[model samples]
Target: MLTFYHAPNSRSTSIRQLILELGVADKVKTVEVTIPRQDGSGARDPKNPHPEGKVPYLTDGEDYVRERAAIILYLTDRFPEAGLGRPVGDAQRGRYLSWLIWYQGVLEPVTILNWAKLDHPAVKASLRDYDTALQRLDEVLGRQPYLLGDDFSAVDLLCAGPFAWFGDQMPATPAIRDWVARCMDRPAVRETAER
Candidate 1:
């Protein structure tokens, strides 16, 4: 049995969608770990899984996974039927992995930095480059329905979220909007979003 330490309104909903996507929704025992409660109501203890006290953590009956990208990739690997990882050595596989990592390396911080209203010269200086990142994403999305091209994969879920889930999320993101809608339409996504 796998225990997924998750919370509502937090990043864990994405993980929940993944469980549904994998078709192993029942195999995954979801533990709703609400945050900021301080009543010990969630996966708040870093020592339990993420060491950083994150919302989404998974224990595959043995090991604990904290990061969203890591969890997505791992689930796809463990359950090949999920089709989220795609085939090995495939060019799209590389692209899939790239987008998955992009969330952490680019999307996460970039979205937060822009949303938080940081005005420090140093902070403000490089922040402008987020447009370039957004541009790159837009260019890629313009070419395909999914980030990896025609196929929907785990990486897609990792990119669209709390930060970029609005009208102004991207200045002109029609393609990105379409892709997000495609992903959200997945039965798994709908189920998880409702949670």
Candidate 2:
């Protein structure tokens, strides 16, 4: 059986939601672990495969997958029957992959910096500011309901996870707001969010 290590309300929640969206909840077992707290006083679960004791890591048999983007890509590709991944030769596959990489590479860092108010010229130059990220997302979302276009995919869920949680940090773009709303409206997302 597949094992998923996660903590409620943490980055791992997105993985949980993705599993739910795949309708493979019964196929995998979820192991909840305490994450490192802001004060650095939480449990560093030995059972968790994450090197830093982070949540949202997945154990597939003897192999371990860490990082949100990696976990999402692993699960979606592993269970292609869910239709969440754009397989090879698909026209949208490139766009799909780009969104996945962009989420971790750009959006994640930008959100953290903006939230902490740690603005620096170098940081802005390397990893665009929050407003720029929002504008780019708005442009894509305005063109289609999901990152890969009309159909919802794991990219939608993965990308939406951050925006849904950090709605306050996002700009007042109707497209972004609507896309996030659509993502949150999914039954799987609501269930995982409640957990």
Candidate 3:
């Protein structure tokens, strides 16, 4: 059994959506606990399972799973019946992994820099949009349908979740917004968000 330490109205919601989409709703049990980040709550302490003291940590009746991308990959791999990923060694799988990794790599840094209101002119000057990494991401998203291309996978959830979660931070993210809208309309997403 899997025990997901969850907090409503937080990033953990995406994991719920994942579990539900994978048709493993009954296999996993959620430990509901509100995480008041502004006030520092008990459930959100990183010491629990999540590395960053954030919601969405999972204990798979054995080992602890932290970070959204880790959790997604863990669940998807743990239950391959979900078909959330492409066939192994497929060229498309590389794209999937790349985008999934980018969620934590490029997305996190770009979002944090924007949220922090900071800039690095030295490197940014050489590239477009002041050479910011987010601008480079925007260029990629402008071309791809789902980050990995035409089909959707666990990586799409990984990328789309953060892209949607960080709304208004990059208000010009039309493609991201449209993708999020499509994801939100999915029955699994609606069910978890409502929960």
Candidate 4:
């Protein structure tokens, strides 16, 4: 059986929600682990396998997956029947991969930098600041309801993480706000948030 290492209210919530979305909750077991804070405040379980002591780690047999976007991709690909993943031959596969990668490589870092108030010119040059990032997202979302169009995919699931979790940190754009609300309305998402 697959075992998911989870921490309540963390990025792991999205993965747990994905499992529920796939209706494979019975196929996996969830194990809660404590990840020590960056300031070394919380308890860090020695039994936890996450290298950096983070939540949202997955152990499938001997295979371990970490990082939010990677974990979402792993789950979606593993359960392709859920139709949350755009597989290799799909025309939207490249776009799907781009959204997933962008969330981690671009959005996340930019969000962190913006929240930390580190608006250096060099940082803006590389990550383009949070407003630009949000506007870029809004441009795409304003065109379509989901990242991949009408149907919601894991891309939407994972991409909405920051907005849904951080809330007011995201810009007040209608496109983004509506998209986030739509994504949050998912039964699985509501259930996950309640936890």
Candidate 5:
């Protein structure tokens, strides 16, 4: 059985939602652990196997996976029956991987910097600004319902998660807003939230 270390209301919620979507909740063991929050309310849990003491870490036998994008990839690929991940031969595989990486590499950092009001020139030059990130999302969501064309996949879960949690901070663009709504409307997402 896979062991999932999660923290409620943190980024791990996305993983929990994915697990529910995959219908593998019974197969995996969820170990809720507290993590240091931005507001300094929680403490780092020694039980969390993540080296950084973060939530959303997964362990399977001797193997372990950390980081949201990596874990998403691992679970989706491991449980391909859910069709949340694009397999290697699928045409959208490259696009799928790109969106996953972009969420963690670019979108997240930009959102954090903008929220903290630390959008320095160097940071903007390196990671670009929040507007730029929003523009990218708007452009793609405007064309299709999901990041990878018509299919609702893990990429949508990853990309739309932040907006679902922080909708007030998200832009008023209809495309992005609607896409987020569609992503958040899923029963799995609702179940995760209720937990």
Candidate 6:
């Protein structure tokens, strides 16, 4: 059985939702643990196996996966029957990977900087600003219902998770906001929140 170390109200909430979406809740064992929050509210849990003591850490036998994108990839691939992931040969595979990486590499950092109200030219030149990132998402979501064309996949869940938690801070455009609403309206997401 896979062991999932999760913290309530953390990024792990998305993973829990994904597990429910995949109908694999019974296959994995979830361990609720506390993690250090940005506001300095909680302490690092000794039970969490993540080197940095982060939530959403997964241990399956000798293999372990950390980071939201990596764990999303791992779980989706592990349960491909759920059709939440684009397999290697699928045409959308490249796009799928790109969005996941972008969420972690670009969007997340931009959000942090935006929340901090730090405006640096270098950051704008490199990762760009929050508005720019939102523009990219807006463009894509405008064309289709999800990040990857019409299908609602893990990428959508991964991208929309932040907005569900921080809509007030993110200030998404109409298209992005609508897309997030569609994603969050899913029963799995609602169930995850209720948990």
- Best of the candidates, lDDT: 5
Estimate every model's Cα lDDT from 0 to 1. Answer: 0.74, 0.86, 0.70, 0.85, 0.92, 0.91
User: Residue 59 lDDT in model 4?
Assistant: 87
Which model, 1 or 5, shows the larger lDDT? Answer: 5
lDDT over C-alpha atoms for residue 66 of model 6: 92
Report the CA-based lDDT of candidate 6 relative to the real structure. Answer: 0.91
Tens-place lDDT per residue, model 4, 39-115, is 76668777678887787888898898998888888888888898998888999999999999998989989988877
User: Residue 77 in candidate 2 has what lDDT?
Assistant: 82
Residues 78-178 of candidate 2: C-alpha lDDT, one tens digit per residue: 89899998877878778888999999999989888888889899998999888998899889898889888888899888888877887766554899889
Candidate 6 residue-pair clash tally? 0
TM-score of every candidate = 0.83, 0.94, 0.80, 0.94, 0.96, 0.96
Candidate 6 per-residue C-alpha lDDT over 1-195 given as tens digits, one digit per residue, 9 for 90 to 100: 999999989999989999999999999999999999989999998888899988889999999999999999999989999999998899989999999999999998999899999999999999999999988998898889998888799999999988889877778888988899899889998887788
lDDT string for model 5 (41-111, tens) is 99999899899999899999999999999999999999999999998899999999999999999999988
Q: Candidate 3: worst 10 consecutive residues by lDDT?
A: 122-131
Off by over 4 Å in 5: none
- Which stretches in model 2 have alpha-carbon errors above 4 Å? 39-41
Give the local distance difference test score of model 2: 0.86
Give one digit per residue, the lDDT tens place, for model 1 in 1-195. 888888776778888888888899878888775465545555455444556667788997677787888888888887887688866766577777778887876677666776665545675354444666678778988998877778888888778664335546555578877777777778886777676
For model 3 the TM-score comes to 0.80
* Better-scoring candidate (TM-score), 1 or 5: 5
> For model 6, which pairs clash?
none
